[model samples]
Target: MDSTHEQRHPHRVVVKVGTRLVVDADGLPRRDFLNRMADEIRDLMDRGIEVLLI
Candidate 1:
């Protein structure tokens, strides 16, 4: 796939990460999950998508 051709116009997005998805049973942030989520957000940003995390 040609990444350069995939560039998109900037847009806004509101992503609400659920408590359960972001925290563990002990009420601690899950590093691995957070890392993955960060990657996803980065990708979206790179695609010119403005992400608003809640």
Candidate 2:
């Protein structure tokens, strides 16, 4: 392993986006929120974190 590489401790993460956060008052999917969350999840994956999305 390279000296500058980060070591994984837990090695995995679970991301549960609640219904309230994922939907509008009309029960529709919020595009902006979903896009933002997707970006964040991608970032975690890029960092070598295993993401379990629900």
Candidate 3:
């Protein structure tokens, strides 16, 4: 595909979250990190990119 096509269209992304990054010592979700990630994902969405989190 041409660079212009890529620049004009939205791209799909698969974001794989590591277990360590998603869980804490007690096996709980890390809210702070999740929140930061959400913010980043929101930014990407705003730019017309699709994000799939795993």
TM-scores for the candidates:
0.57, 0.58, 0.59
Per TM-score, what order, best first? 3, 2, 1
Cα lDDT of model 1 by residue, 14-42, tens digit: 88877766675566678976877789899
Candidate 3 lDDT over residue span 1-54, tens digit each: 998998777597789887766665566579976777789999999988999978
lDDT by residue for model 2 over 1-54, one digit each (tens)?
A: 554453434458998767767675566679976777789889888988899978
lDDT of 1: 0.76
> Which pairs in model 3 have colliding backbones?
none
Best by TM-score: 3
lDDT of 3 at 11: 97
Clashes of 3: 0
- Name model 1 segments beyond 4 Å from true: 1-10, 19-29
